[model samples]
Target: MTRDGRRGEAADDPVDDATLALLLEVAGTPKPGNVDRRRDLDDLRFEAFLGGAVGARPGLERAARAADPGAPSVGDAFVRAVEGMAARAGTNTQFGCLLLLVPLVRAAADPDRELSPDALDAVCRATSVDDAVAFYRAFEAVDVAVDDPPPGADDLDVRRGSDAEPALRERRATLRDVLALSVDPTDPDRVADRNAAEWTEGFPRTFRAAEWILTDEGPLADRAARAFLGLLAAEPDTLVASTLGAEAAREASERAAALLGVDSEGPGGVGDVDAIPTDAVHGADLDTAESLAERFISEGINPGTTADLTCAALFVALRRGAEVAP
Candidate 1:
């Protein structure tokens, strides 16, 4: 029970945390080069995205329920939810977010509500080969852009879409196994996005983002915006790096850090530096962030990985009993 003696969760409604966070994420303005209340991509509209998120609520809830101890494997929930969402949205709106949130929702909805690192890892580790197949099926349902497959991995080609499912079965690869192979440890030249890395490392960044959201103040959207910038500033967006290049992604992160007047090193690094002007974003002015957003959109630079992290943070916040802003 919450302090108000009501059942504690993201909301009282039947809708689950994944759907709610997705809705809130798309609705957040000044999100920088992503579709939000303030802007929309030429091919996608804000309302369409909102409708898609709401439409996927049932599947997200089911996925959460499926994650309960002794219940069915939870990975299929992601595939079903994404399939349902693709049908509704007609595009790749929330695939990455879905990937991050399904496990979180499962952990949150546990009978004990034991939302912890260990619990989340357990949920991820429990995934089966069926979950891996479902994940590829979800990929087939959308046109999500990603880096090219490393050489010598013909069956792992994501572009193969559903065709890759058969190969997955032959290898008996689970969702975790797929992620492990996504980023080759031997290749120093290759880079994996935080999302993919999370699957292998047990989602440290998502949990850390959630922890930041819990301690953050201000409206949820503002907190989300800040978190988004922080994530980008700290790490180059893998989606951007893959679709564009490593240098482009690094520049995007540097620009975000400059806008927020923070650095990858630590908080308030820019402000504390004597060289940067006092008028710099020491206070993290909202207008400066918006300005950076406009520049990013114009430059065709989208920090999608950062946005995914924000949604993960929002899910963590809502799940941990932080009151949502009206």
Candidate 2:
């Protein structure tokens, strides 16, 4: 169903689904340290996200036109989307979300393919050095919160933006190749880049959480908030790690896991939201989640990478026919 409760009206339109996903992600309240309908960070307003979603549509349209002749490549679409999103929001609002969405949108554009991890993987793998250059240009559009590159990879640092273009060309790196660098942590104390991991590892968390959202009954916004919590609890947020260190990121995840009444230990490791029974996340859990949201906001511990994953999951859920009725 569409946002207005119309079934199948825009079901075939990946651009519409992707745009709605962005709006719905931010609309989910108590998302904990992220912008939502009921809360705002000091630097980012709820309205800014709305503007970013609107601005991203043209690029999404480009992605959805992938089967057509002269269509933009995945990285080109991503760069255009990031540029438009930043222009409208006056800052970087959905850079990470666009990073995930563009490939999924491109994959969904193919008439012969269904949107899945394998399809997304193929789309990512097909990118070229030109795509890598376009991706680096996206970094110059706005300030994205990413960790510094590992030792001796300074020429490939994302913050170098277009300046890294020559190096990327010299190395003949594809967009996937650039993303591969951040997929895993170099040290025991560091947290892996969750967004990059999704890109290189076929979006395991996004697909898993999308299934969670689709199967659960309730308003989509509430389901999104729950999925947000689940993804955050499952792993430490990469953005949190970049800004607040690995320990602080783990602490945030543990706190979320505790709110869901799950043991933060054992085989799945700490804060596995999947371990908690589905029905257990109600009433008291939500109340505690609200409190946690407030605390995370006050402390400036935003789990932004988790939010980005939730947005990608929402896109998948929408494409899979998750109802958007209020």
Candidate 3:
């Protein structure tokens, strides 16, 4: 039970004290609920990307897929085909989300994305809320209600303007810019504008951050894997065996650390959130989208771990036209 006597299991995992500290840092933040202000763009990307097969697209679905290709590995061929469609579709969020899911679209991707121990942390960092949502729309199913409330209720507080419409109008604003790649990639001014757009409307910054984490010594996988494992609650041994190659004991220690707030080190905790440098963000972006997504997923994106709601939202927005994932 929470301090208020309500019940909450507080997300957990089995890892060393230090590792658990990092895991909790990513998972224990105060997330936006059904009626909250959070947004899980990372999880959204993963969900949308992994949700379905790209081949679901009728006529284009079976151009090269042989019903019985006696190849040693069909996964590569399938991924190549999906990646082709994604590139042709271009670098837009919708397309990017499709690209990340290329492996999944062809078949049941080894839920692990083939991450070796050397790349485990890198890939996890790679999968933060920001980048994950962009290319994983089909796999999206993270739950968050950023949708504007019914008109005239007049109770919302996020907006400070007299009229709620204008205060948070941009939240619901339609995706306006035409999808066009820049001709001058090296132009500083153009790059600034592009960067500016990405903070509020574009997802490049978030994706880049995720990409960095996935490739560097980041904590994306631990955050994602733990949340996924616990949410599924499918027996840690089985889950770890299938995914982490054997690390169930690590989850318990991590869970304890997350709840205790001992050495937490990410944006979800108040310390990490506050630790975010103002100059670093430069008045351009909002809070970390991945922080919100990871928190929400652990909290229960939809009372289940098999799917993610954020990914679903990305899919819905793309289908409706938002240029790409959240």
Pick by TM-score: which candidate is best? 2
Q: After superposition, how far is residue 199 of candidate 2 from its true place, in Å?
A: 0.8
Q: What are the RMSDs of all candidates, in order?
A: 4.6, 2.8, 20.0
Query: Which residue segments of model 1 deviate by more than 4 Å?
Result: 2-15, 67-72, 184-189, 264-283
Q: Model 3 segments beyond 4 Å from truth?
A: 1-173, 176-201, 217-268, 271-326
lDDT of 1 by residue, 150-207 (tens): 6666787767877898888898888887777665535554446568777767677676
Consecutive 10-residue window with the lowest summed lDDT within model 2: 266-275
lDDT of 3 by residue, 1-326 (tens): 32212233321111111122222222422222211123334334322322223322321132213224542122233233334434433321232222222222222112332212222223222222222222122222221122122344233321222233342244332112111111122432111122112222323222323222222222333323323222222111211222322233234223322433333342112122223222222221113433543554454432211122122222222222222111
| Clashing residue pairs in candidate 1 (N, C-alpha, C atoms within 3 angstroms) | none
The TM-score, computed over Cα atoms with residue i paired to residue i, of candidate 2 is 0.94
Clashing pairs in 2: none
Instruction: Order the candidate numbers by TM-score, best to worst.
Output: 2, 1, 3
Model 3, position 36: C-alpha lDDT score: 17
Candidate 1 backbone overlaps, count? 0
For candidate 1, give the lDDT of residue 317. Answer: 75
lDDT to native, each model: 0.70, 0.85, 0.26
Q: Model 3 TM-score?
A: 0.23
Between the candidate structures 1 and 3, which one is better when assessed by TM-score? Answer: 1
TM-score of each: 0.87, 0.94, 0.23
